[model samples]
Target: MTDAPTLHFGVFEVAAPQVGGTFSWAHPRSRSADFLDPQHWIHIARVLEDSGFDFLFFAGGYGYPLVDGDLPEIAATKGINFSAIDPDYLIPVLAQHTDTLGFVVTLSTGLEHPAQLARRLASLDHLTSGRVGWNIVTGASQNAVADVFGQDAIVPHDTRYAMAAEYVELAARLWEHGWDDDARVVDRESGVYARRDGVRPVVFEGEHYRSRGYFGAPPSPQRTPVLFQAGTSPAGRAFAARNSECVFVQATTPARTAAAVADIRALAAERGRDPRGMKLMAGLTVFVGETEEEARRYEAEFDAMQTDEIVASLYAGNTGIDLLALDPDKTLHQVLGQGSVGEMGTSNIDRFLGENAPTVREILDQLKGRGTRGFRLVGDGTQVADGIERLAAETDLDGFLIEPVFEPADLEDFGRLVMPILRERGRLREGAPGNTLRARLTEQPGNDRLGDAHPVLAAD
Candidate 1:
């Protein structure tokens, strides 16, 4: 049962650079393209599609909430940092150009009305030809709160998940309940665009939001975008167990990752879910070369290339603690704080990073590999493949979100060089390309819709 556990080879689309968005290796020497150059995505989409990648996602967050306490450096480097043409807009451009690549976009449940999310995501699925996926994220950063809601206001962690529960409930209803499969009958004789009896509005009234549903336009190929969640907290994990078709996790050690995987699957079982159906993806970064010596040199190049201040800003932004103010070696708990690490209670990653509390230099070294605060893998193709396989063997993860060090080339190398090994070893997903994101992922039809065990479905 564990063989070929469905690897989702993907790349994070944020254009990460050095401090306050200092300078990134991705675009350090080249002319910056519009939206970091169309070529950047074009190459990315093409490579991921050809390499048997399950999807390529663009992560989103609201506002540039700079954490430096002084926002100027972040402000100045905004163009260079991860500034983009927006993931929603980018998905379509890539969709027209690529065949099998799925595109996932991150959307915050906290800020959107369910009706709007439903409509937008459904339209995206149609536009992308059933290859769209939605990453349900509750806002994490305090600055996101200030930008999306207002200054000095933040919701507690559990409550946000509570709101998230309702948000997803409403969204699922909109996407799944509104259109029955038989709704679209184009009999030339009747010539009606849609059957009214087969289609009806979905309604939701809840504590967080209330919507009198207007059935969002015509149903697309897959009405609901593939469900995904990345929160690792108890509340977040519970949410993933119930709703997520795929889950994202991060950890430094194989032991930590293995423990996390067990916890999530346990909760999914506790909730009476088919734990096997939920594919878990660990976020990872890989720096590869033809030989081990070459790989070491490449790591040195990336190490030499980094600017300390930028790494500091990236850390500050993620931890929500001003790096300038804290003792580099001290635990965040030692300093103690008011809100969650993601604006809730302390986060798992924060605690994990805090364990032994590596100094500033160590944290930077770790991050240089994954870009964000996730796992790092560095080696040649054989070593890289072995490392990924070992992570799967040790942690029991379904697959991973492979964050890239360089643009098209890194992804190109993986799909071209690395993925085949995964496939040959049967560590990756197999079979013909699927139509909908969920179908490709789960390999089951109708399962695209939320099952009865889900809390939202129960309410319905």
Candidate 2:
């Protein structure tokens, strides 16, 4: 009989509070003051490393929180803060504090030039010694486009994906072919530097972006950063299959997760790549305690603090559907079927509408107390472990991106309690002192770079 697949774990977080209604400085454990503190991030890095996590994934957007074309509700309710201080700044600091922990930082294709992004990521890979991953996102919020990118409106959904395809393609050329492995030569006797022939200009002109100069940075340990994508639409999945080594999906049930995983793997296979090489991680949030009742009590406390306005604001920000404009009594299927919902185009809400058909009230209730709509696991250590194992088995998921309800404390609880159970069950990684993010996640040493089948390599 085959052994159970070795499970990888990562933390899904932003620099700020991930959940809505919990951003207040009034919270006794609030770390809002330390949003810019290097030491605070250091502490988090150490904690994650100690827990044997594979990576700390940071998700960020470019603008402030918005609701119904304005930020009034988000400002008043203090619902989800989208203004996470740049992860690019935070990763270098955290990399200095920890040895094995991997950092995945989000960057939007619509907001930055591909060549510039390639330079930044290449520099970071060297700084982190091959422990960095890039979470690639096509822009989401119109506010981000207007406020940050200085655009009049957000790009169309399908058009954004097309631009991202070209963006990544150009970036990949820079990363993969700009500099040869033997380019850097430090020869004192000859007084020579890098071999001139080993470096070449990457010239490309696409509909959305173009690059026509030699990439400035030399190759780092991993060469190109491990590519990560989170969209689940058909175009999104195709992009992930072509470029991503890791992919994230949000599904409310094991069956949905399984289907999504299968679809992604099939896409990878169609692209002439190894499906198993693409690590598919489902987003999950867990609340753990010494006892089952204690866990429920903690969840109850969180649920009690949730407000309807906060819920509506959060939903609006996510789906781009103005929940306040819709009747609470109307079911999601009814509203969506009636063509009343606007075209914001987020995969999470799309999946929800397609799969669950929950009412507006039910959707609000689901969002109450929860930061994300991913699967929720709440119980003692054994119960949580069982839930994880069952979910993995049923869904064929490679791992989970654990979303913390409360910073550090929730993670601490999982590390102290749930990790041991997972370890004993052979569902967790044995702590390794020095491992690249790619190595740790793929569980294969010396596999530090993208596989030959990766589209980036085809440019050669």
Candidate 3:
């Protein structure tokens, strides 16, 4: 029999009261209201670490879904995607309590300067003991970005990727080349803290960004903190192939995901990168129970919390299309022909426009919870593991980023019910104490640093 493929696991979270489902906070079992308490996050980190999760991935950006320059009723009143605190501040505290778990925090290339962003990330690497990763994003919604950040003009879609390419290059240079590995001497007898010759300024000039000065910090472990990118558009895919160590994709279907996976690997090969070096993780949500019937019951309960009206409004803010105002029976093809989608999320829109174009009502039901987009499995522990194994095999995916339907309870259930089954099958990594986040995620034993093939290490 062929050996089972090893898969990494992570939790997809936002720093908010509710993440995956609308009104998920209303669930009797949910403790999402405790998000503000440091203990809440600390308990979560401990649970995940004990459960053998590879990392905690925080989804972030400044933009909320807006329609006609106003927040939708569900978004405004129910706090759907509205109460996000910056996960950056919360990481240090979580790091203090956990020993092996990694944290990947999202920061936009659109909002912060590359130099400052690099410094902050490097500091996080040090604080977390090299258990840090960065989810680099070009703002998904340009209108929302402009509204929230008070920008005078919107940067076009492709142009944002262009700027991100420049931004990432500069930041990587600072992380990889600014200071020599042995630069810090701390020679008390000689009164020389660092070797002056070992440190040098990283002078970079590009169309979108420029930097001239030595990086403010010395090298941390895994100097370039595992670079992660989540764009699946053409420009986004190209960017991921060139720069990302891990790529996050939201799966539309098994066949489509397989195609995307092949395309990304092919793109990497064309760029002179080892195709296997890039890890692709898809967003997946699992509803598990002791029996299949119980699992279905749980799924139905969550589904019942969604209302068509609220979901329709939330979809409008995400896609820049007011679907609620349209004919309920109109097909997505008809809707798309009516107007340009402009700068909102094309990825979400494309999901509905597939071969079997869904109607407005169908679209609303599918998007009942904003982040609940990918493959959703409802089953008992063994059955759920089988589904995950099959999905990974079919799609050539490296891992799954679990989107919790309810915060701590959902995670606890997965850990208690499903994790052991996978572990016994040798489908998950064994304990690797003292491993850097990169090493853990990539399953590269003892090597915490980026490989020689990475663009960041290429000679200028």
Candidate 4:
């Protein structure tokens, strides 16, 4: 029999009081209220590093849904994905507190100029000793963030992705070829700091963006941060095949997840790239306990935190579809038939439109449980491990991006209970001694760089 694949583990979080529909910030067991506290983050970093997690994936959202310039009342009042302090600032701070755990921060292509973004990430790469990854998003909340950026209308979805292609190209060139490895030579005898002749400015003049300058920072442990992308659309899958080292999938079922993995790998193979090189990480939330009955009780308590109003508001904020405004008795099919969802709807909406059409009431119930986020497990250590092991065996998933329902506590429970079982089964590897995030994830001991087949290496 073939040996089971070792799974990589990461925590999905945001620099906010609550993540998604998890309105458990006010719950007695939650530390989400301490979001603004430096110690809170410091505590999280230490726990994760000590728990043997691979990285902390910060899913950043710049703004809430604004319909006709009016913010949803419940979004603010209930604290649903509201007040997301910049993760870029938080990542560096957490980097200071921990050593091995990697960080993957979301940065949108529509948000800033490539030079500024590139320089920031390169600096982070150095500061973290190369334990950094970039989760590239192409303005999923365009209309919501448009007013904040002083734009009148949402940019077309494909247009944003197209612009992102150029944006990443410029950023990659700056990281890869902006300066020679020996460009920064500090020679006291010759009174020379850097060899001017050795440094060359990487010039990129694309239709969407143009950059012609030396990279602000030198090559860090990983010249380019490990690229991660989460999109399952035709364009997104293609983009991931071409650029991402790890692809994040939130499919609702094992079969769907397996198909997505096959599709992307096949796309990569067609492009003359190694199909097995890219890793597929699924989003999963686990309510783990020592006993099956105890786990269900915890899941129930966590579910009690979400209210109907908060559910409607959070869903509206994410997909621009107001569940309350629409007739609760109406099926999702009826809702979709009324108009084109266009860019407003996400893959979550697509999942609901699958095999069976669910009513608005049914959908709201799922949202209340944070169903749209990803696959969920509610069981004891043995049962949860069984689910995880079976899913990995069936879907060929390399890992899971664990979403925490309660701040630190949920993750703490997972680390204490489920992880040990996983390790014993040989489903999780012991902590690797690799210094860089790329090296750790890829299991290469010393090399902290992207493979030659990566598109960034070919960027001009």
Alpha carbon lDDT of each predicted model: 0.69, 0.77, 0.83, 0.81
List candidate 2 segments past 4 Å from native.
19-33, 76-79, 332-343, 354-356, 431-433
| Residue ranges of candidate 4 with Cα displaced over 4 Å | 67-69, 333-340, 432-434
lDDT of 4 by residue, 1-460 (tens): 1277779998988888877555778877788878788888888888888888999998886777554347877667767767778878888888888879999999988888998988899998988889999999996555678778898777766777788888888888888887777888889999998888878988888899997777868877788899999988777888888889999976667998899899999998887788887889998989888898989998899887777788777777667777787788877665664432556546667767767778889888877868347888989888998998888878888999988888788888898898888888877655554478987887767868775557756632
Runs in model 1 deviating more than 4 A are 1-4, 15-23, 26-35, 68-75, 78-82, 148-152, 339-349, 352-371, 430-434, 445-448
Q: Local error of candidate 1 at 393, Å? A: 0.5
| lDDT string, candidate 2, 148-237, tens digits | 656766666678888988888888889888988898897899987899999999899899898788998989888778899988877788
The number of clashing residue pairs in each candidate reads 5, 0, 0, 0
- Residue-wise C-alpha lDDT for candidate 1, range 1-460, written one tens digit per residue: 3455556666666533322233445544322233455666777788777778888877776544356444537434533244444568777778888877888988989876888888888889888878888899887454645654666666777888889988998888777777878888888887876788888877777898887756755777777788888877778888898788889876658897788788999988887777887888887767677777776766666556566555555555555655446566655554455443556423534554544776645555555433354676778888989898888888898888876555555566667667877778766664244467777787664445555566557752
Q: What is the lDDT of residue 292 in candidate 3?
A: 91
Candidates in order, TM-scores: namely: 0.89, 0.93, 0.95, 0.94
User: For model 2, what is the alpha-carbon lDDT of residue 36?
Assistant: 67
Question: Could you tell me how far off, in angstroms, the CA of residue 67 lies in candidate 2 after the best superposition?
Answer: 3.1
Candidate with maximal TM-score: 3
**Higher-ranked by TM-score: 1 or 4:** 4
Better of 1 and 4 by lDDT: 4
- lDDT per residue, candidate 3, 361-423, as tens digits? 887766775444578998999999999999999999998998888779889989989998898
Question: At residue 396, what lDDT does model 3 achieve?
Answer: 97
